[model samples]
Target: MREIQTKSTSRVTAQATDIVLRQTDSIRLIFRPTIIDNVKNKEAALKGIFLYQKKSKKAAWEDFETIPLSSVKGGEGYKLEIKTAELLQLFQELTQLYELHQKEGVPRGQKRYVQATPQLEQLASLSDSDIHSFSNANVAVGTSLLSKLLVWATSLDDPSPLIERLVEINPDSLSKLNAALGMQSLKNALASWEENECISDEEFWQESLTKHSFVLEQVFSWPTSIVKGKAYVGGKNVFNQDGNIVDFLLRNRLTQSAALVEIKTPMAPLLGAKYRQTYNVSTELSGSIMQVLNYKHSLQEDFQSLTGRSGDLFDSLNPQCAVIVGNAGSELDDPAKKKAFELYRHQFPGLTVVTFDELFDKTRQLISLLESEPRVEVESDDMPF
Candidate 1:
């Protein structure tokens, strides 16, 4: 995904660690302080912890034991111990619960309940060996696994074990999960756009582009945030001024610089009829570029007044423009025509000329990265069970 420059001066913070495990005759698990600080409620984090075990590598996990953490000792790091056999049993139960949750669809919310069969008090016992093994798994996957456990625990009559584990989850884990889900949604949206049988009209393109301005930013490499759709370049409600509204207005989050955007339907032409046996920029393409430039000029002229009223949100100097129009269809089928289009696009310094197909291709490539890139992992010297 393209990186957008943020306005904030501080550096990005690292995600917090949740749980670390070590294995020997007994399994030892350590919970980081950040987890306890981020739970939905204090009770959920303070309750006794559950130990789930898997019978075999190939078998599912079943409920094993629940251990209260009130007696556990550590200021920043809390430790819990469980016999190896009991830990394995608990892991097996967790795996079974995870599988069942997956089949039923993970539930969302914070309702309290207790399980009838597992019987929270039946056993109060237990607790990794591959420190790097756990580290190798993607952070996104770990978060998903944790979420499944939460869902499974919540479904039972007594959710204390799972609820307690929730306290061990770092708040940053939720941020990672949200990002993963957002990327998945963008991929699905792009796939749906590709699968549509009929091409969208100009109005539809404009509306969709406004809603998904990130797609526009990706294609143009603008690296800015969308400030407003159908922005009034001539200043608020000044309809009498020429070029009163620009399709979109973008602002650099850090610099507060502005850019103007204009949209045209994908069916618009990339190349017109040959002139002197050579392809040239189609009228539609030229017109859109000129339109964006005109909007840029309008914004630049009104910059002082606009920024005065909005508080330095629009930079008067060095305003940029971009026009998203046309599709590289049959007209640009030949390599020569495609090269001509590229050369034409390069002629503009402050203005960018991009095709709808180019935007779609960029989005598709971004979606592909989600699968190709490995999930982010963190390494620690902490013991493994």
Candidate 2:
């Protein structure tokens, strides 16, 4: 008997082992029993007999034929048998058929099977020893590479590379990442204010808004198209003879009209003591409103002088005014008090009154929306500011 050794490779849980091909007048294939027990029926597991041929030592292995496995059997482990002469005849027929197709060109809608290169075949049929060796080496190499990458990332001053990589991997994550960064920045700003105890200082409040004007823009619902003008512009001889300075002066980009802003500490009162069984606006809030209105009046009175020097930047005829003052405390908790406050606010046409708490709360809600629904389009009417 001539023995033909064939490579055995496992593609499933059960492994085919000790595969040997013995040739007499007929060829017999024998293999050891598989270890798989999950299969309900062992006979059904045998599908077909596959034949592979290696044309030369340098050539890749190719499938020769697939025949029904039920035709031949050996009771011991598992076996198949086929006539040697018939196999040779089958090979000759296939070779002729392939040559004929090559000359005529393959018909449309039919694909000709192509064998993989030798290198790819070797990788697909890696030995058990090779698999264990690769697994062991991969663990050590992979761990070392990951550790080095972590160290490099932590040592870098800029995070753009890492952020870019994340965005490249998944573009949908960009908005969520941006929102997280924004939240961290806001936290840092709040922490700084707490540490420095500057929240109560009017000058510090103005400077903070000046440095990060986006916060002010969001609070006021100002469109990005508008331009923020000078801060603390002294009306001196131009707008007022008293030399009063305005906290912030803003102008519309398209109209070139100006607006006045007055900021107060959050600790200021929102409502004052009852007078004649009716709640009145706190002295702090009323004073800020009057101040902003005075600035507007002064600018309108001296519009000619101011326009000549500042290139007609102010719309003195209908300048808008806004006051950022105290938090909405217990006063707004009562329904009657809330109604009274709204009624008072509606009396002023050109002036807007916004509480510090309202602004901060709106900011928080905006951040939450960004985190939860990053891709959602926000409408202008949906914004509280």
Clashes of each: 33, 0
Instruction: State the lDDT of candidate 1 residue by residue for 50-72, as single tens digits.
Output: 33333555554344565456655
Q: Give the Å error, residue 289, model 1.
A: 0.8
How good is model 1 by TM-score?
0.52
Instruction: Report the CA-based lDDT of candidate 1 relative to the real structure.
Output: 0.62
Strongest candidate by TM-score: 1
Residue-level lDDT of model 2, residues 17-43, one tens digit each, is 223344233333432322222357532
Indicate the residue-level lDDT of 10 in model 1.
Answer: 19
Q: Which ten residues in a row have the lowest lDDT in candidate 1?
A: 1-10
What ranges in model 2 sit over 4 Å off? 1-199, 224-241, 307-314, 374-385
Alpha-carbon local distance difference test for all models: 0.62, 0.59
